[model samples]
Target: MSSKTVKLLLVGIGGYGHFYIDGIEALADQVELVAIVDPFPAQALDWPTLQAQDIPCFDTLDAFLATGITVDLAVLASPISFHADQSCALMEAGVHVLCEKPIAATIPEVERMREVRDSTGKFLEIGYQWSFSEAVQNLKTDILSGHYGMAQCLSTHVAWPRTSAYYARNSWAGKIHNAQGAPVYDSPVANATAHFLHNMLFVLGETQQSSALPRKIRAECYRVNPIENYDTACLEVETEKGDRILFYTTHAADANDGPSFLYRFEGAEIRYEIGGDIVAYLADGSIKNYGNPEGTHMRKLDVCVAKVLDADGATTPICSIEAASSHTYCVNALQQIPVYTVDPAYLQVKEIKPGEQLTFIPNMGVHLREAFEQQKLFSEMNFPWATPMGAAVVVCPIHS
Candidate 1:
């Protein structure tokens, strides 16, 4: 028997769109990229290649939807501000959606999306791709198998740097609003640190469990840059299940410092160190390392697609809407907190000091321009966006 090919329509061929393509290519046997929509024409340089391979490209989503593309799935890679609107539009048009993270800018928006999804009976999967990591999967299996007894504590650190140039590259680079009140339009927890928190939730199997809402959240944020957003934050959350999760993220740090996620159980500890290596230790002096030095984050989406295609009626572990929403809620909450403030005048000025070395800013405008120039640029692209060049120095001397 021939396998049924699931047709896909991808929107936003910029950052994460490239990852969607990689995942689609990895699962080409089970899926097909039928159409693509990206607002910027220059961003579609690879359209000819996809077109030659029988995929249609459109400049707008409405045009693609009206083209009778016959796609079963819609992959949304638009900016955070458009997530809810685009997802709702796709689902209303009877297409299942796999949207990029921070499901929506606000809880109300998330609720609206959920309502639309349920009313339309179309599946909505918020893309929290880290849940599909091998290390994360193995940890989930171990946790579910009762090997760790009960998960007591989870801690994650996602300290990375971004330069002033990064914020200056786009008009919306570090802005609080996109003419919309959604705090996630530009924020650290919403854009960058979301994955760390999501990975922790995934490992703990708290994504689908409603008995585990975070009861207490105490967070402190710092805005070293002039941009009206927090560049770094440290959070302590206590879940109703008695599990404590500590999360730290920064947009200002040395370029060489990569991201890390760590988890601790009663008798076992697991660490996903920088450079894609997983290290674990058991109480009985057993230590193991699972390294994927060449692994790209795109593989996470590949795994998610495969699982969704293979699952029965219920949503798969990776593509479950509820699972994604859990992560989204936490990220949105973190971004919504008015933890830090910065002056817009400072944002416009270039600060310089004697003997201070120059560093490049990882402005979103620059990233978007690069993406506009390079159609193949994806979310995990080792560009300046992820690795900002300058030091994030906290300047607020007065404390309230």
Candidate 2:
């Protein structure tokens, strides 16, 4: 660790890179930006800021590492295809990392990453922002403390609609694999509404640094958009202990709500919505509030920095790679199920303007809400358009 200040590396200066830039600037006093790794850095960062900071840009990670610049921490905002390679490379280069979510696209890549991190002795925290928030951490702490007794079942739903512009915003937004044949598995669950799904598995972990693995999962996928992957999904994952975790999410609906949850425990019921407080109401008439996960922007970055600087060697990033791999596990398992296309009868496209349009299914939100509330799949609700998951169960492998 750098005694005076942490030396940092920034990767991918576009898209979500803007958020990292803001966080870096806010914590400028405690850290120094050592290098910027991006093919074209100016897309998100202005020339003025770069010139003032005197930061050098590299066309690739290989080029930057060749310079032998010592970096204590590296924040990866790169694409999904590059995460496995880039994270392993940085950790092997003696840098702790904060890589963005879904961990990687496949279980094999995730296993490879875990191996490298273990061998290199560097910590890698996946950028599941909500997991690092005080609210989630406190909730997880309580869950581990047995204050909630046993988790009976959990359900989460997110309905964030996306336009053509969103999928067109990047080359890999809806792709299952990148052009390089690397697994990306980009979809609503893997990318956009991922935090919520991952949160369900995260808080139910047996320990602080580990998440519960899904022993079995059954899923149904559908796509209304002309993309490589499904735009909507509903699935049920069962833990080894046989507790149910249900998730329903979509980007192909007209409604935009949620990231809300209903987590049932033996002792209490937990409920939360985005931009609102998290409440756990117990059977004994006691209630606890866990604030809101969105209360802090880039709070994950701040916590990682504090972990590096704190004399407390035991302190670590709240969201470790192992804890995040469960999401990847769920993702890979979902790949086995076929992605069914929605019938055009339910599809409608509203042109926002020339060269822009929003596509959605009529009354899709209502169907999704019913499934989520009932902790049932669309097929179980007997929707005519829905298809059964049909014994498409997959068990996430326990690496141990």
| Model 1 stretches astray by more than 4 angstroms | 44-55, 180-185, 206-212, 288-296, 303-314, 335-337, 341-400
lDDT of 1 at 213: 50
Please provide, for model 2 over 73-185, each residue's C-alpha lDDT reduced to its tens digit, 9 standing for 90 to 100: 99999999999999999999988899988788887788899899889878889899888888888999999999999999999988999999998987888998888777888
Highest TM-score, which number?
Answer: 2
**Who wins the lDDT comparison?**
2
TM-score of structure candidate 1: 0.76
RMSD in Å for model 2 = 2.0
